[model samples]
Target: MDTSRREFLKGTAWMGAVAMAAGCMSRQSAAAGGASGAPMHGFRVAPMKRVRVGFIGVGARGTPAVKRIAQIPGCEVTAISDVNPARLDAVQAWMKERGLPAPKEWSRNGDKDAWKGLCDSDVCDVVYSATPRPLHCPINVYAMAHGKHVLQEVPGAFSLDECWETVEAAEKYRRHCMMLENCTYGEEEMLAFNLIKKGKLGEIVQAEVGYQHDQRSLQYNPRDGVFWRIDRHMKHHGNYYPTHGLVPAGRCLDVNRGDRFEYLVSMETKSASFEAFGQANFPADDWRHNAKMVKGDINTCLLHTAQGKTLSLIHNVCTPRPYDRGNLFMGTKGIYRSYPSLLMAWEEKVGDGGAHKYFDEAKAQKIKEEYRHPFWKVAGEIAKKVGGHGGMDFVMDLRWAYCLQNGLPLDTDVYDLATYSSIVELSERSVNARSSAIDFPDYTRGGWKTAQPFTVDEIDMSKFGFTS
Candidate 1:
């Protein structure tokens, strides 16, 4: 091996907690809640007009996100920052081709920290960051400190310390700091959430959610100018990307609403596929072939809620398998599972043998349509047209714009970001301790006791000049 196994294992021991704490200790006090006539805990912009947006990290995710934001009526891409000048130039060229004015560009200018200039600039009302995991907290804190609301990518923080910093920064700035967890807005997932909210699930007992995609090609490819994801896989051994599944699952379970995640334990199978790929793709003598990998091929984490409910979350990226988010909810009266959805319920009907059975396709479709989330029913068409992750991503962007325009609190708040992303750090602690239970932090500061449960409230279309 290029490095001793002990050296590789030693890398995981450092939490960077002290550095994070010292950095946050000097930050200004949390921002006060909104003034009268403003939405709760929201900072309202005067005479709300088109929201000016600044984007950082315009690579694969940010490129498409900027395009989707440009399609929204009340959102304008005002500024962009990227370490890759080619990406910035490409996006500017695309805007010009589409007859939209080019945005101000913030280049790295020999400083790897150039994103800070974009965050500190006055050109944008909302700062959207799609940077790698390590940079999420720093960029967001800087953005909020500069009085800009933030729409950041998923798994917003990599460690508990970073999560705390995010929560404190958002509260202190009194500005919106929403994680862009698009899965929560997926058409089917939103419908499931609506059913859960209406008590159709009849007290969810256990739920299973996962990011089970076999996209090793993306993970192994280093030519795209960013190997951060690959680097994370090399250095960590826990559920790294938890938000895609955890956020929606948490919302359905009403995490941090009526219930909060109490504690979690995780276990993993030995790593194989990544090691095999390195041997086959790289030179035999190359260090890549011998680099020590700590990540498990598949990781399973079980989390219990304060109400005694459980959430089963799995993460698998190295294996060859079909793409599946593993959205499954088992309730007292019924159950729902997706990837071409299937529903079985005691309420639907009984089988000829006098047993509860699966609902017929037609009946199930009718029920889903009936309970279909209002947001999807009203805006699903536009979302499809705008088109990101089968419209869910676009819907998320438009909703962020709508909330900002109307001065309403966001769908996924700062606490949600911290709690869901906490799984990353917490799962690491659990796995390293031989699957010992790790307690979840109550980022809400005891507010979960009375916080309102998740809702499927549609955006106020009229505010965005839409007449749905």
Candidate 2:
């Protein structure tokens, strides 16, 4: 074999060993619960009339999130943090342009941990972070410890230990730590959730979900002579971004509510796409040309729930494909699929006798209108007007603020954050173990059996002085 191929195999073997070691470590600590040995399920705190928001990493995701939060009724952007001073200035200028006061800035001028200052201060009641994946848990744990609730971007924690740390921190500090999983609030996702809730679809038995979109450009594009995302791709070999597809599917199956993920087995195709792309694009001496991307081009993981339901999850970013989450749910009485087109099929007794084929446009529209989530009915127009990922981002931000203002439980809590994000490392262990099954850590500590499933509680915009 050529030198490059031999090195690649060596690296793969090393990663497999590391995954096994991490699994052993995780199992040793799996029994530990929160600091107080209590679960944070259904946990609530006193209402805040106005939730002061502090933003960390005002880059791609954070900038739009800042804009959306600024528009929410009970939210105020009082503090902002970013390593880049230019981005901080941009947000300050934008706030000034809208006749709002400038937020206090936290930049990496002296201390690299400048964002922590925002968490320590009294300027904000909650901290929202859209920073890199690695910083998510540290920021969240620190924010909660400092008496600030935290809302973090997707994949809330990278490892099982971080997941447990988040759970424990939230329980100890008595502060909220919610993962900002916007897809859960998508129009169709919420519709499916409501359908399942209303029994439109009988007991959901299986689901297929995925995050499949070509991200070669984003991963390979040089930013400061560093391929941050691609570098991680070269190092890890698992479903790094599983929550996008898993959260919605898990919710539809009532995961971490009445049912919980028990074990999962994962497999992946060879890592060829990135090397091929680099060979065609970069020079011989460029790091990309010689980098052996360890992460597979396509990864498929099969997860089994405690209640015997199954979920098939796919993750692929290196291929040429249209964006799709593979939001397909199958139940005893009906089925819903949302890709390429929105379609549904119901048994004769459940619907108008179209079990053999998907509903046409008219029937599909009728069913959608009938089972449309209450959230969309109230905030859909304004959400569309604000526009992020077709209004789901706005709805998510609005719901987070609404719950905080009312002292109600968030739609997605610390347990959801931990459970959904845990798939990242769990899948890696399975993949490295040659598709062996890996059991999930019970982050909820047995609270899931009785925890109430998520409900579509409509927000009364008028109560917050909005006429919609």
Candidate 3:
């Protein structure tokens, strides 16, 4: 193995042990009662006229997020940290080009913990991290502990203990900790959410969601030099990337609000597709050919909610196939499915037996326009112009800034982060235990019962000069 791979394995082994110990302690605390800290449901802070933001790991995701946040009216990128100084320089230059002040840099310079300095500094009101998976929890906890709100990449926690740690930290610190689940901000997803809120789907009974993108080339690209994603596939099993689909699905069902996931059962197919891809693409002597891919080619996890709702979550990164999020929602009076295309069917009357067919294209378009989310209605054009992941990234960042600027409770709070991220470890446990059902921790301490459902309130685009 290469030196970096050897060091990564060693570090991963140590982290696994630490995670287990932490998990045991957290469970013990839960058994006694609950976390010592208060719950962060509907938590809000004083409004900031300009929310100063610090960024860590300004690579692919962070770079675009920084640019988008710069365009937002109430956000100021104050600091950026990364191991690569070149990335910092590039971002600084971009800021200069945009006539924005260059952010202070916290480059590695032989210290891998350089990002901690950014979190500790008082320059930023919030810290956003697009770091590797292992660093997500640590950055979140540390940033919140230091009195800065945190915005982290998807699957915020790698293990159950990390999930608990983030929740406790946010609660104890009284700061917003939100997972940057951009998928929830997608135009289609927002439209679906609006329809659900408007009773178009009736009572949602089940949701089918999954991340099924073929990432063989990205994972094993020679030019990229071995991504950490492929390393995850080698080391772990069961839904390593779940939030892309789960967050949007959960939002439709009011997860961690009116309902919470109760238990999960997961199963996986044999691991062969990744290895086969490596063999077919790379040389016989390449590291990919020799690496052992332990994770299954596909993992499907079913979750039961406290309200008796069901969710089907799937994860598959290997195999050559068309990209799909597998977003399908089944309801008592209607159904919405988006894979090959957007499809919906609903009954005009309860049990009238007229909901057997989907709406035609023209009708569907009209309904979509009528029920379009307010955020899209106001900022859709600007979002489309800025553009990232079909403008969802911009919407997500814009909403983050708007909430902070207005002192509104975040659409997705700490509990959502904990509940959604806990799937990574929870699914792994179920898979390793021969598909045995594993109970989900009530990270909200039963607060979900009274939490309000997410709403699609319209923003005044004129305030940001986006519309008149």
Candidate 4:
């Protein structure tokens, strides 16, 4: 192992020690139901008939999400807010075309902060924000403060402080706040989750997951609200879009429940490709061409879990690589990987050739069918019918609504939002400090020790209306 990896292990060991000490110190207070500053609470609101949703940022992502949420039977898209009037008008027109009533518009003409008023309004029970990275924390905090549940976009917040604040607000206000990490809802991931629960992959030791898409055009395109993404790339130098793969990996590893992320070390490749892409695509006089990106073309982050499991996260959005999340889960008994989507389990399943071979398409299909998750069995077809990112987005929306309507806790709670998103800030700190180990915040306080692992089968789908 290299120095950085050694340092990361040491840092995680230190964090584990601190966590134990903190838990010991707070045992008495926790037993007495003390209001510790730590996020030691859950979101279990009273059961409601329908969940009314107010949308903020109806741009590229929000548009599809809004439409999907509208299709969910027990959810209402009651209000819409956006900085751009044209986008608001477009949403309203689209709703009208769908034979749905135009939602109450909540834009303040040119105010970028108009979403705050919508959050404060009683028009909606939930605030669905697909805003830029910097705005996630503020909007979520405000929404929760005003008694609205939140389903915000991924990498829940931008900075460590933002992560803490988002968690604090959610815990303090007793509202469900989930990061919309739709990738976790993918079919294969769900299958992996079920297999993990079944011990098909015995005692997961390590995994690799991340966003590896070449989003160069989308990043620098001024038309698609890429300016904000570009700005983030220019300012940050770590795993900016970590949640896409991290969330699914965490679910497999049982993060925030059985295994908490302890610490991470990161190193980044030089930022040459994006600069070259910019020069080739944009005009010589354009700032996008001349300006240099601070973020490297690729970032690799290694995280240690409290349970001694490890996670390798890769972030590369500017490169010319084909879209890949690199979802490779390993264990004592088996391994699973995406890209071509294959799995291998103790040579027994591979038919014992005295050498390793991945399961062929037919065998893999059989395995998936045999171990298909209960949640997918119930919701997959409808999700596919509704369609977003191969139905994962729709599945996420459905699950959120189902949980809220049933008064159950979210799968990806505030602690999840904080811990997963913290990689953005922590990895940068690590890379800038010569790949030093950085301690992860225990946003769950000491609750992860006893927190119940979320089982997909435990979800009460009978409470949900799955219209075909």
lDDT of each model, Cα atoms only? 0.78, 0.83, 0.83, 0.79
Candidate 2 vs candidate 4: which has greater TM-score? 2
lDDT of 3 by residue, 240-289 (tens): 89999899999999888888899999999999898888777778888887
Per-residue C-alpha lDDT of model 4 across residues 189-299, encoded as one tens digit per residue: 888888888877677899988888888888787675558887888988888889988899998998988789988999999999888988898899888788798998999
TM-score of each: 0.87, 0.91, 0.92, 0.89
TM-score of 1: 0.87
Error of 2 at 3 (Å): 70
Error of 3 at 416 (Å): 0.9
Which is the leading candidate under TM-score?
Answer: 3
Which RMSD values do the candidates have, in order?
A: 12.1, 12.5, 10.5, 12.1
Query: Candidate 1 at residue 322, lDDT?
Result: 85
Ranking by lDDT: 2, 3, 4, 1
- After superposition, the stretches of candidate 1 with alpha carbons farther than 4 Å from their true spots are 1-47, 108-110, 348-355, 465-468
Clashing pairs in 3: none
lDDT of 2 by residue, 141-231 (tens): 9999999999999899899889878887898889999999999999999988988888867899999999998998788884434466677
What are the runs in model 4 whose C-alpha is more than 4 Å off? Answer: 1-42, 224-226, 347-355, 458-462, 465-468
Scored by lDDT, model 2 comes in at 0.83
